[model samples]
Target: METRLSLRYTGPAVDEGLMDVYQASANMIAFSEFMVTAVKATFGDAADAKANVAGFGKGSFITDLVFSVGGPAATIFASFTSDHLVTVLQEAFGLWKHLKGSPPTEVNQSGQSVSVTNNTGQIIQVQTDTLNLVFSEKGADSVGRFIKDALNQTGITGVEIASKGEPVAHVAQHEADYFVPVAKESPVSENVVTMALILVAPVFQDGNKWRFSDGTGTSSFSAAIEDQTFIARVNNGERFGKGDVLTVEMRIVQTRTSNKISVERVVLRVLEHREAAQQPSLV
Candidate 1:
């Protein structure tokens, strides 16, 4: 009952004016009376329809945008069909194609499915009987807000993410599409860039390079360190391995080859290590 959209932007540079225009369009959809009325009519009184003037389906909208100069800036937006809210948002974005010359590179839709791991190595048959929705990375305007608003609108008793012992809020970046120019000058040089990210997957050595998961669910990078001392520490002893939750600072070298800025590899450096504090388990 959910629609996921992956919008790709390919151009030289995305001017601030383009972002402003897209933001204005998004706001129009957010405040559109026709869309709100349609949602309220579809869901009816017993279920959807919040006390807020916007009403029904307003809580289902979630967007994430990642834009880098000289690269494809993509935005992912997810919505639900229980109240026809997702459709309305999609239509709103579609209007851009008619108004502007180009449209989004891709649009995708997927259903909700639960994946369970059998760590015990025992055969188990699971049947579908109950349904539940869990929200993570709580924020005022993120997925957490949508769930909260949906509960209030539907009068559904649900536990807030904070109540489940998670951080109530975190920094959030608003995501939307932008028009990038095709022939702009390079903004940055080939320098080592640093980033701090959470290690989601187990750090495993893949040949000479080590694969890493930054938990972004989209892009993953590989690490190659010239320093053999650190490699010996990890390979010989259990200094830092899988299941050890810690914040890592990584050094990345971005080299522009031809027209694209290519990130050759990332060097894993442990700026801070807290082995005892395992990764937070969201209930």
Candidate 2:
């Protein structure tokens, strides 16, 4: 079913009926992804959701659009009223806000319902199937981070979710930080293994990952070099260019709740560094 919703922004960002195209696009994209996550988490794994903009209006800056929730479980969404979605968003944001700055001292959850007790002993509870949307995150996702960044931008004050031209949910400027997700748990596992990587790009910075890839086209990733000796050699003018092969011990860490798999590539040791065959210059 298609639910008409308007994302209206108010403040200096939309000055005189104008908003930066890039900023507007970023916010829209982030919100769309957030909605997609919310839909699946709320309805079920089989439910898919997407947003389509119909037009942009500028009383305070609004993108009038439709959220198409479809898939095998789409019927469930049809029965979900606009208020239901608004409640989900509001509660999700509220949960994040509480978790980040002033985390709950204790959380009592019974399936989809949760009761949180803060440091001040204040207890707040929310019951919704979408509670897990914000409940299970070690850190804010790139989408959530981007949305928070957009909201905190200068002149961008507030956001309101509306249906039928009436506001049903509101996110105030002061609440912008609520969208910034915080890490909740540590990685599930960390394993070290020796792997051969071909240098794709080199970083000379103090703390930045260097890009590399295996011979196969399947994977390319950036990793932090932890071999002090090898790094010292590079600092002393060791000529390692792109396509150079390096065999090193790399650390792989996996976090389940956030579904994050990261390569720290401590590069414990560089067993070998083979120079790629040089191509003749056509000068």
lDDT of 2: 0.68
lDDT of 2 at 141: 60
TM-scores vs. true structure, each candidate: 0.27, 0.70
Compared to the true structure, candidate 2 yields what TM-score? 0.70
| lDDT (tens digit, per residue) of candidate 2 on 31-82 | 6666667666666667656677677777233433344555656676677665
lDDT of 1 by residue, 1-283 (tens): 2212221121222222232344333433432332333333233222223212222122122222111112121111122233234333333222221222122222222343222222233222211110010100111123223322222322232311111122222111222211111111233444454554444444446456655556568775566655455556667765655434444445555643224565665555555444535668899
Candidate 1 RMSD computed on C-alpha atoms after optimal superposition onto the true structure: 21.7
- Badly placed stretches (over 4 Å) of model 2 are 1-6, 21-37, 45-82, 101-108, 115-124, 135-149, 162-169, 172-188, 258-264, 278-283
User: How many clashes show up per model?
Assistant: 4, 3
Best by lDDT: 2
